[model samples]
Target: MGKEQEKEVILEQMEERAVEEISTHDAEKSIEEKLVAVQEEIAGYQDKMLRAAAEFDNYKKRMERDRNAAMKYAGEHILREILPVVDNLERALNQGVVSGVDAEMKLAALLEGVQLTLKSLLAVLEKFEVKAIESVGLPFDPNIQEALVMEPSDVVPASHVLGEFEKGYYYKDRLLRVAKVIVSSGKAAS
Candidate 1:
């Protein structure tokens, strides 16, 4: 081969190699850019997940605080209503010891005051949806009445409530206390 032709061949080969290297470099740069973009997307998703978790924790803590407050303040309204009755009883007792009144008169006055106080208390209970259970003359119910004794009676039928020892009460559709009563047995067996 001639010298000039050989040199020209070498220069062409070098130019081709340079082009391949530049193409390879561009490909590597493109891949690096895509990697950085994918990493940024992952970081953004992680930040969102962390924020959601923090929000859920805050929600749980807020609910717990509200529940505790409700528990702490429970029955406060009922006790406030009952306190006036207590005050009335105290007033009655204080005035019950007035001088110049006879013992019998004082006793009567004190009893009247107690009756009024009891009526007031009962009214408050009624306001709060408390009601007395009717057991006398009704058939004995195990759910609301407790049988104290069985007595033979001509008037009351068997398994019927004859007399109540203590009145039962219901507080807002729920039983507060069971009625204690005597059940009657049908006329004695001959």
Candidate 2:
């Protein structure tokens, strides 16, 4: 239209572009700051995760070392107890070989020594919670007793244990060995 109006319109357009550029620059700066903050947060979280993973690895290693230590010395106490019994047996045998001792007297002494050693061994077993299962005169239990033979007995009733061949044993509430026993088949028919 008119020259004056055209110039005014061009100046207004230029001002608007300048204002738009400034606003766009401010928005870009804000976005860059937020992106940097998010990156820093991610890095912090990664560091924490790495630390936690390392801690777990250390825990596993500690437990493995403790388990190995336990396994290595697991039976130390029992072996220590058995050592005394071994010493007693050695002494008994040495006594049997002594000079000028009569054969019957030496034999009796040897037997007595062995009996005492056995009693000591039993006491040790009991201290460790090892127990003998009573099989004689009791009802036969398949869980703890193993029947080796069926015998006819006048004293023991049918399905009852008459005699034990080998004693059964328990170790602390767990069955260690089954008792070998003879089960009665009741009295003979008249």
Candidate 3:
């Protein structure tokens, strides 16, 4: 309507444009900052991925090593278990139990042959990494010792092994059979 009013209105419009320009510049800067943060996050994720891949490779190698070791000692347990039987047979022969005099001679010869056979068998087992589990006078371990019975004992502590009824064998660290044992029961815990 009036020239002065028009000029005032024009000045107000110019001021509004300046404010919008400032806001646009701020928005552009914010967008750039956000892009930088997103890039940083992506870089961090990539680093984590690389670490995971490295860990997986190490795990594979470790597993392979364990597998090979298990394979190497696979037969050890069975052989170890059979060792006690050989020992028992040898003991029987040493005791010299027989019937007739002629039969006794034959039996003695048979026992000697059996002893030699057992020795040979044990030697073969030894080559395969088979080992016997120690059961006598030791603690009763459920992992290696199977409790045949709990018996009262004065010499051994309760829960300890009093005697091994049958021997256990191990192939490497794996148990083939648990040793059958009698466990000692202590003085009724008073």
Clashing residue pairs, backbone N/CA/C < 3 A, model 1: none
Candidate 2 lDDT at 152 equals 95
lDDT of 3 by residue, 126-177 (tens): 6666688888888889978889899887789999999888889987778888
| Deviation (Å) of 97 in candidate 1 | 1.7
Pairs that collide in candidate 3 are 76-130, 77-170, 77-171
* Model 1 misplaced regions, further than 4 Å: 1-23, 186-190
The sequence of per-residue lDDT tens digits that candidate 1 reaches over residues 1-190 is: 9999999999999999999999999999999999999999999999999999999999999999999999999889889999989988887786679999888988888888888899989999999999999998999999999999999999999999999999999999899999999999978887
Summing lDDT over every window of 10 consecutive residues in candidate 2, give the lowest-scoring window.
86-95
Q: Against the true structure, whose lDDT is highest?
A: 2
Superposition error at 155 for model 2 (Å)? 3.3
Query: For model 2, what is the alpha-carbon lDDT of residue 53?
Result: 100
lDDT of 2 by residue, 59-176 (tens): 9999999999999999999999988889888888887998898999899989988998898889889989999999899999999999999989999999999999999999999999
Estimated TM-score per prediction? 0.77, 0.79, 0.46
lDDT value, residue 60 of candidate 2: 100
Taking all chains together, the TM-score of candidate 3 against the true structure is 0.46
Candidate 1 — what's its lDDT?
Answer: 0.93
